[model samples]
Target: MYNGEKRRSSYLMLFIKNRIGTVLIFSVMPLILVSGIILYQFKASHYEKIHAHLGTLVKKHKQNIDSFLNEKLGDIHFIAEIYSFHELGNETFLKEKLETLQQAYGPVFVDLGVVNSHGVQVAYAGPFKLGKAVYSDADWFKEAMKREYVISDVFLGLRGLPHFIVAVRKSVNGDQWVLRATIDFAAFNDLVENIRIGETGFAFILNKEGDFQTKPLMDVIPEKGPYMDLLESDTKEEVQIVEKEDELSGNNIYVSAFLKNGDWLLVYQQKASDAFSAFTKALRVSVIIIILGSIGTIALAFVRFKNMAHHMEKAEHERRLMNEQIIETGKLAVVGELAAGVAHEINNPVAIMVEEAGWIEDLLEEEEFKESENIAEFRRALKQINTQGKRCKEITQKLLSFARKTDSKIQEVQINELIEEIITLSAQRAKFSNVTIGCQLQDGLPVIQGAHTELQQVLLNLINNALDAMEKGGGTIDIKTRLNKDHIVVEIADNGPGIASANLKRIFEPFFTTKPVGKGTGLGLSICYGIMKRLGGDIEVQSVIDKGTIFRINIPLKKYIGEKQDLIM
Candidate 1:
């Protein structure tokens, strides 16, 4: 499209496309930009609030669970530090202490056990019948011996029931011993389970090894979730929120926080669609509105630009017509100047020739040969020269009169007098073309107020066009003037081949030509039409194909049109 080497592109289509693009850029850019910015801010604020709220909930739950475990461990350590190992080793005394603890803390302290340095439960109280149960090689005993205090992940221990321990180790007289207690699994499980949120939200705990420590609300695979990723990522954030697509469930949201001094994780899981449902709905509605608004903007720009282009084309056409009219006016002015010059130059020669012929006739009538034989012939020849020179003088006078008033000053005009001047101007061309120009004038016609040069030009153009049409063969151009009611009417009819019905309608339209190339500019009748209309008059035409054409001009009377008295010049 850039280069016109092989084939040319239609630049009009290019212009239209360019305009459409320009309009869309200016119009739609702001709409999309503002909408996108607003939506982005809304999404950011909404997501920040969600993450903050979930983090707060998870942190609170973590604190309560840690406090519960620490309190239980402190209780056991208090008993170990207060009474001697000998006192705790008595079965009856251990039973009494366990009863006191259960009375204070409810069933959260299920059972108490006293284990010796040799991994044997020296004393047991309540619940199971383990008065003589051995504690060697047990996992809790092994873990309890290593640390001063421990809260372990839930495990099915010797009783074949889900349970975990809060154990405290003490050294007395060079002997190491663990005072351990069993915490109720149902009571600890309630802490994690109660952290539910929306429809698909639930909280659970996982150890460092990706194994569940508390029962979850729904079935979960520990190996295949974003919580596992959060667990391994080792980020320092207190609460981590992640959204990921799941193979079977579409999208899921996971919020995680480290629990139990970074030994386990408290993770809350929910569907992402459920977490930010309000934002999603708002986004959908905004998108719909923007789409509809964009369509409307494009349609409006298209129509507006198309209208502007159409008006521009029409204005260009009118400008060309005006330019042509200016050229026609300049041509008429030059022709009038040339006509006046020729008339002045020819007038002197004809006057001199007429005087010289009279001088010769005077000499022939006088002199020494009053009875000479060639005197009659010479007198006849002198008479002939005198007649032709007088005719030439009259023609030049007519030309000077027509050329003198070529200005557009308003003055009173006699319609018959203008027609007579036009007939005299076109008389020679009519004779050469074998055409005759005839005029029918009625005297005492009322004067019309108009421009003299413009009226003369209109009549002269009609007569000359008639002469051209009949140039191929002889024809008659009849001119008539009359007072028709409240107006003055002039009719110029030609007995030449008339205009076709098709061309007759558009005879007064500018630049609409049916003539051969260079023979016509087609502005004659259009200028005439404009002139008549500007003078508060009208020009009309009627024609048959083979008969003749008649052009009529009507000028409104000044008195009838409520104007001042007509100025007679």
Candidate 2:
């Protein structure tokens, strides 16, 4: 029973070694590889597409912001170019012009002022009441004088409201004068406040120094705002996407575009999770599909293994029964051949008996024979007849012994001794075929447990086939035996024309053979294969074309005692 468990374990190992790799390669690996590829492709393309679309949106908004600031600067430049400082000192004309300008382009401008070269506000209109305010050390005044035009960021103005100045400097008669307009900060904020991205998305404007130019839409900004470094750095790219973290949102996605005209940045930001909701959903679906596919593959492999194992078990049982029948048939064939030899052997004794009888009759018929001499001759003849009869009886007994059948009786058998017995039986055929038979039997080999009669039949069939293979070109047959691990191995090798590679795999199948039609029945190797399996052993064949063939038989040294007892019962 322990040996049976070991055999089962070996079979399981063999099955796993053969089938698991195939299952992983054909069924599992492809699914995993394909799923991974799909997920990777989706992630790369989807995010790329999202960033591209966001960049487009940022570009459009950037153009709007740039155009808005450019128009304000153009307004100040147009006034400076059209009106002289002397004319702009006329408050009536300037007030009318400013009112008309405000009515034309919405209420964006808070007021307009003309600053003389002396840095004093010479003329002012609307809102702030700085009639003649000193212009001097203001940053906007200084920048306008240096750059000819300037657009300032949001700051607290004279009106105590957030507003920015768009100013332009003109040289009139070699004297510098500035035309300045203060625009309402609410108008600048309105440009981006109404623009929406997702539920959490908003836009803001930042100056070149990373300071807020417009009122921020969010109340709290994260410590490390997205694109803050880019705004401060010397990066040349005008537009890009930035990933960062926010105080309110864990991860944020920001698309930023730089405005060259105002030296400001337009940033559109949203929560990454919210922005990529569709991609997240798709990823979830793909992960689920991969998991389900993995489970399904494992289940399918398991089912196939179970079905194959069951079928193999059933086939083995059927093969054993069929092998017993083939063994009986082979035994009958051997017995028929032996019958001829036995008849020839018995005929010699019968001829001797007939000769003795004839001699006794002739002595009786002779006239010169006395009573004593006749009696002596008759006794001698009778004795010779008895001896011949005994000889005939011995021959019949040998024939009967050869024909005896024992059904699956298990016993400890010396493998070498068993091979010698089969050799004796096939010696006559081997001689007739001019084949030389030899043995390399290992001494003190382990005894194998199996049915001796069935094993003998297996050997006889193999030896006869070997002899037949070498019949035309007489060759040597080498039978070798050895102890291999826990099994006894027998190798029957013949120097005959070897089997072709294409036909080698089919040799153990029923009705498959390489012999001529009338010369052989193709059941020999198939029967041998089945019988070896029934004996809890295996047979394998190897052949090289034009060289020879070797049939290896491996039989376990120990058989399951319970199984043997069950077979006997």
Candidate 3:
């Protein structure tokens, strides 16, 4: 039994799995798979585009910076080669040169000075009073004496402001003199800071030793951004990209390139999410589409599955109806066989007994019994035997006729006679169950047009139910037939343990029963309800707890149907 149940369950589960599972596998799964594939490819391509664009920007800005530094250095070199020490040593002459350079390049040339090989300012022109400022221990001065010309990192020299200069060394009469020009710090800082892209993108310059050549907008860590690494490396690659995570700013993209002959690194830093924000947005949209598509697919699948299940349920109901029809056909056949069996089994014996009783009567008429003391009693007994035998034959004929009424042929139904016939039919069961069947059928009741077999069935079912109701403790069942306003009415009432109000209203509903498991099928009253409705009649019930119940059926002579019901208090 368990194995059979398991097999049935597995088949049902397999059916269910195929319903929605196959839909999702074929529709939504492929959508998700394709979307994932496309998104992955887009991610790779977008990252490459972002890196390439940032790298190009960093490289181009680095070139501009290199050109700016070289241009300023070139200006100093031209001045040193054109003017001699004695000519440039004059403060008036040095001032005129600074004015000319500044006029040509805006305020980029802050000041001009000629420094000696010993790091002493010989002549200073433009801005700040530093006529004899000594710079023997200064890094720019020391580096300048070694190289032919030098571009310095930002420093707070004599002016105590962040500034750098381009300078060239000249030798005169075995004495070394340097021509130096200060470039505006703000202009150079603008040069790097202007390399902005998104909100968090900015640029700054870092010298070989990890010092800022220009002021960056935000405080930056050279180690975190790997500025120090790029600066210290001897890698000939001019431009390189790296990504790192920072404690304060999350992940950042770093693009670095060599600047000013590898003396400084032009590094651009930006938040990674901000740099690839476009790609992230696209990814979110893709995910949303996949989600919405999945929802739509599942919803459609559910609708389709529900439609299929509904059709299956409807088909099953139809199949059950067909099976019930078959069962009803079998029941009619069995009833017919029962009727035949009763006639064959009981009628012949009854006829034989009647014939034997007559033979005894003939024997009583003989001379031997002429002077019998119980002659009158014997005649009366034989008469009663003959009457009972005929009555038995009448009952057998009634049963046979009732059983043969299996067809649904419409005809004029005599309500009074039909009620009498059903009462007679139920008399035996009523006697057996100790139930008294009584009727107050009115005479000359107007006949109604209906199915005779069905009307008979309705009356028989009601009387039999009354018998069953009073089976346990015998009670009375009263059946009444009357005529009112061209309609014939029949009311069946029983005085057994009464039906509760809750059950009274539902007694006509199919599959509602108060009888024990094997005693009732619960379809009798329901069938009666349907029959009366088609016969242009109404059936109503009234019951009180612990009292009795009345089922009143009304039938009309007109060939129309209406649901008119009235409960008699």
Candidate 4:
């Protein structure tokens, strides 16, 4: 009979927890969540679309640059062949031929030179020395000799001007000779510098190894040397990568490309923020609408529930009691679900703040580094630290806010802050377990209106799972966040012992812990999933055994806070 009573109590608890009536109890909150989710989905979709669009544009631009260079090189090669046949190695003959050719192709072929088999300057048509200059040791000379005809990579030449070489090798009277022409690099730079496809959008180019091949910002000068030795080695013509902070925008950028030059990794890139500016503006407008709508919905819901309860006193009293208990249970479930993640999330900000503080102290002490070239760099580093530290604070605050309540509440929250915290805490955890953590946070994030507690719960669950999957050791967790059109995203990832392919589909099921008996309840993730779904957000996990795992959560920002009284009641 005692066992039977225990079973009955457990069934009742389960029923109360899962009953659809719970939705009614949390109707207004759910409505707000749904509205926020719609906004989030719209925003996410917009970002994907914008990124895709920018990627396509960059690729097309890269192709154009490649085509332009190839066409120009082809023309120069034909001109060089004509000169070779004409015996232009003779100074007098070369001078006369150049004068005639200049008139016909002045814009395209500004200067021509006849180089001997050893790549030494033999005859020149331009104002430069005809016999004194030597090109034997030059990359263009070496490359041309190796190939019948080759376009040299961009480099600063004898004129101290950025140029690329188009050279063709010819066997004249059983002697090898190189016919070469120089094309101004500035010509290509000017072609794409000011062209914009959207607001604040301007395109730039990068070499295959992700270095700026053309003039980037006013301050990003290429290092004094060969271009990282990468341009000449990379055979892939179709790869692109976003530029990290340098002299440009003081932030990272979205870069794309089409492999147009086999010998060059030419790609075009644009600022992602600029490309998605329109969508972000639209998202903000939507947030304002949702804020107003959420208030109205809440008021209507309060009035309806109040009236219905007043008319059905007994049922209302019982329902209210049951709801209070369920809410308490849900709150506990959320806490349990988020235990490991909260540890990691909070630990992150604490760690970063500590590191930044230490750096600040170090900067104050290091007068030499401060006075030298490191000054500007140190200042920038500090700025980034503060920026990132504040972000961490915001995330922790959000988590604390969420953990304090069972119902929804809107507040000004920064998504990057939350993600940063997760990154910090998870990184520490990963470090202890021989796992590394990575973060990719976006800049210039806007404040949002949403339930902080729910978001925190989502973050916590995802992070903790990553920690556990590593079993004994050797794993990595990556946490990142970005602004979609109208929503914010947080992604948690891990490289640990992964879930079996078969178990992957069942991981989210309630009470499905795969651990040994008495180790886990499996309700943690399910409850987290429910909270996110209720909040109009979502949590998804992907993993592979002996490999790793990744979890992504998408949530809407709270645009406004309605009257305090209508919250959770």
lDDT of each: 0.79, 0.77, 0.81, 0.63
Candidate 1 local Cα displacement, residue 115, angstroms:
2.9
Residue-wise lDDT of candidate 4 within 1-569, one digit each (tens)? 34534764565545444542554447646666776788688778987776667667667766677777777667666766666645777778866766765566554555678888776787777766546488889987887778777777667778776777777888779888877776656666776775566544555555555556567533433442223333444435354445455454544454545344444444333455566677667777777876676666656655565555445554654576466545645664555346435734676767778686667857656766656766667676777777767665654544333333345665667777876765676666767777676777778888766667666666776777777777487666777778877667777777777777456555655546788865665656665765565555656665655567777776666443334331222
**Which has the greatest TM-score?**
3
Q: How well is each residue in 1-569 modelled by candidate 1, as lDDT tens digits?
A: 12421222244455567898987788888888899999999999998998888888888888888788888888998998998888988889988999999999888898888888888888888799877677768777788788788787888888898888878888888898878899998988998999988788999999888888899999888887786688887888888888888786668888888877888899988888788887888889889988999889888877776677667656874686566645644554455456558868998888899899999888877767568899989889989999988777765654544345324678898888888888888989999999988888889998888888888988998888888888998899999888888778889999888887568656765545778965775667766765675576767776756678898888887722423321111
Residue 432 in candidate 4 has what lDDT?
75
Q: Lowest-lDDT window of 10 residues in candidate 4?
A: 560-569
| Higher-scoring candidate on lDDT, 2 or 3 | 3
Model 1: worst 10 consecutive residues (lDDT sum): 560-569
Highest lDDT against the true fold, candidate: 3
Q: Write one digit per residue (lDDT tens) for candidate 2, span 1-569.
A: 34544786678667755786788788878887998898889888988988888888888888888888889889878888988888888888889879988998879887889898878999999877889987687778888888987888777756677788999999878999898998878887988886677787888888876778876677535337755675765666667788877665689888888885538888888888878878889888988987898778777876787678768866885686467546644654454345535655777778777677767767766666645645776767677777767666655543333333225677888889999988888888888898889999999997788878778878988888888888898888999998899888999999998777567656765546778874554667755765676677878777776688998899988784444321111
Put down candidate 3 lDDT per residue, 165-278, tens digits, no spaces.
788988999889999999999998889989999999999998888988888888897766577777777777778888988798899898999988888888899999999999
Of the candidates numbered 1 and 4, which has the greater TM-score value?
Answer: 1
TM-score-best of 2 and 3 = 3
- The Cα error of candidate 2 at residue 279, in Å, is 3.1
